[model samples]
Target: MGELRLMKGNEALAEAAIRAGVDAYFGYPITPQSEVIEYLMAEKPEERTGMVVLQAESELAAINMVYGAAGAGKKVMTSSSSPGVSLKQEGLSYIAGAELPCVYANVVRGGPGLGTIQPSQADYFQSVKGGGHGDYKQIVLAPASVQEMADFVKLGFELAFQYRIAVLILSDGVIGQMMEKVELFEQMPRMSDDEIAEKYPWAVTGKKKGAERTIITSLDLDSRKMEEHNHHLQRKYAEIIDKEVRYELIQCDDAEYIIVAYGSSARIAQKTIQLAREKGIKVGLLRLITLFPFPNVQIQELCKRGIKGWLAVEMSAGQMVEDVMLAVNGNGKVAHYGRYGGIVHTPEEVLQALEEKIIGE
Candidate 1:
């Protein structure tokens, strides 16, 4: 069994990174998630596991470090909060365009600008839909608890290298700062140079005599070639949506109404489910795990099962609710309730919104 400890989500994630065999971490300090690098530095993973942890001057510099290391076939990651993440979008897009394998975490706070240090899910659109330019989507893992904050790190890196893509652990301030029991995974040995060269033939290792020299670039001036590359990315995304969709259903087997949420919002909605059920409201919850490979199929299945209404709870104005509506496709009543710009809603508020928006309506 792995060691169990009560740890904050960000620290748990850091521990998981070292254990998951990440070769490098490059990140700038940002609130709610600054602990990730702090823990990494304090624990001295460099001494323990030979993991390189560096705090870059800015988010742009940090992400470029990840890109450079990942291009050389090293397992790498970074973490930042919302505004810092926004600064890294260009680098993220470049990484995605190059089809490099890496992972990053956005311990989300508020935003449009520097909104608040408190939690918010307003980054949902940017994350699931592709925060940077171009038609690309990161495999987003929304962790609902401290346990998942640790677990998704392993899963994120796995998915990243598996698909040759960047993966996102889309967390929030609450999950990042909140302390809870977490099971730390066993330490994994970092892949040897031979192993990386063998596994990632596309990686930029030293060109061997008569060996194919790897060329990594997102820019293709040739129109048709760029189109082909775009098609390849689209196909990759389609495969991910098909094969990697993940979610959770709570009290949904026989429920007539569904409350859709993810991450910290889903945690609160769990409590809302209990309250609704106690009041004889037969409410259930659909918690999204992979927000990009959104459980469209599952939502459709629930709709077919005659789920009467859908209430979407989030820390956004109404971003994820649109997806819920599209998934429901006029089969049920759909409404959204949220406190955006860094305000976190409570279980009671979620229940009341469900009553008025879904039930009372």
Candidate 2:
């Protein structure tokens, strides 16, 4: 309820997950994100809340464990960094296809290969546009600070269960390792077993003596049934897009330029915005909290409001800028700025881009 103590981003995320009544955690130890599993291990919630925590064989096994537990209608979660997360994509696709509820924390590190153990928001498309195959969308929560790491875990789980979907807490290594103050609630309210079963009756638990055996699976022998299932998932995604668009508008009242960013990149953009204001530049930031929904409507509205240029500042090479362009609808100039392979851009760098792209122009 009140500010409690300083905690690392990964540690806070684990604590918040425990408080959120997560039933099971299955994950392998990966750099940066390993602290999340270590926190759970050290805290040992089983003594208090009867939670299940398993250090799995690999990220592959961990994601499958999430699939199994989520199929049972229990709140479940797992965590990994970039390469580790990439390993779990097949399982993630299965979870998405099955339309199960789970939380996956991706403490993003360098990419394209086993690049480095530093922060990078390079997985923007992977998190938002479906890391795995098939037409699907995950509820991606982009957390900017250590406190956000704690907060988004609970919100992610709630949204996942509510929408019958997977949710991703997309953070980065710097955000993961940093120590910051966070107020963790005493406990989070949880739905009862009866309530869960009542709400998600399709979950596979063995049937009674006379009842039919409930099957929970993404597989359909018939192509038409599979098509129907895909249609249902698409409808759910459409509803999420309509209802779950979330982003922050900073000083856009009469802004001449809009800086679009999210996750840790958004924090850097905030500093850039402050500097821009001090320099008498009428720039604003639209920090997206929900990456999947993409907040296209906000960007579109800003473009309509005479924002001459939009800067897509990210930690990677222009992944989200594609969406920004789509949202701008060719009405204004959209430019991309970033440093990839685990290099996070500084506020000065972002401001420089803004200056060169907007002011100089």
Candidate 3:
């Protein structure tokens, strides 16, 4: 364990990047997340830990830089908000197709276009459902707190390299700007060249003596080969689904209702649960930690336990509710409550929605 300090989520993420031994960070400035790169620059991680940080002109260039560094078997990362993440979709698709490992964080703001600088979970669909053009998936981790904002950087990198796939940390403006006490982890040294070669033999580094040169690309001219590649990706996604479903079940025992939420919504739902309980309403919360490998099985099992109803709370217009409905499979009624365009639902509002939309009915 390292020292505990009060930190903002964005700053925690930057410090954790340094401790996680990231080789490079290439990112463009975006609202609610610009603090990430700003902190990195001010810290001068290059002097402290030999980490390289560069500010790219656009999200497109930043993600492409990440692709290049990751293909060469280096630990790299980037961060942006919703629109910027939208711009990086092409590069993300390329990274996924090439099967390179890297980390990305989207400190999301409200948006379909330049929505708002305020918090939102509207990007849930985009993050989990392959925002890029491909039959591929990236591991998506939703951090509900400043601690998790820091912790997920290392965890995301671990999973990315472990599976040779990209990992995304999905956060919102509330979590990004909120201050909280967080305990940091001990610093880790960056991987050596030999270690990288041993771990990622297929990386696009220079060829070894008599070894075939490695090619990092998503292009396959042959249709059959591309089909086979897609199948391979499917297998990887299945493996991740089986092994990495993470969620938090709070006050679930004997509860009659469950509230499903992730990221900042989870925090609000927690308060809603408390308020509901005070009124003698048996309410519980299911906090999703990994959005990509969604805890579907767990949700299904909870649904089987005969809960009366469910409320899927989010900062968007009921996006994640679709997943909850699918998981419930009509076992019970499921409703959605949300505020869009950067308007976050308060605990009172969530509780009211619960009573009117779910409990009352």
Residue pairs with clashing backbones, model 1: none
TM-score, predicted candidate 2 vs. hidden true structure: 0.97
Q: For model 2, how does the per-residue alpha-carbon lDDT over 1-361 read when each residue is reduced to its tens digit?
A: 6659899999999998889889899999989899999999999888757778999999999999999989988999999999999999999999989888999899999888898998898888889888899888999998888888998988898799899889999999988999999988677655567776777887875566887788877788899999998899899999999999999998989799999998888989999999999999899989899998788887877777889999999999889999999999999988999898879899999999999976787
Indicate the residue-level lDDT of 169 in model 1. 97
Q: Each candidate's TM vs. the true structure?
A: 0.99, 0.97, 0.99
TM-score (C-alpha, index-matched) for candidate 1:
0.99
Model 3 agreement with the true structure over 181-299: per-residue lDDT tens digits: 99999999999988988978878878978989899999999999999999999999999999998999999997999999999999999999999999999999999999889888898
Q: Which ten residues in a row have the lowest lDDT in candidate 3?
A: 199-208
How well is each residue in 1-361 modelled by candidate 1, as lDDT tens digits?
Answer: 8899999999999999999999999999989899999999999998998999999999999999999999999999999999999999999999999999999999999887999999999998999888899999889999999999999999999999999999999999999999999999899899999998888899998899997789988999998999999999999999999999999999999899999999999999999999989999999999999999898888999898999999999999999999898889899999999998889998999999999999997
- Every candidate's lDDT: 0.94, 0.89, 0.94
RMSD after CA superposition, every candidate: 0.7, 1.3, 0.8
Q: In candidate 1, how many Å is residue 272 off?
A: 0.7
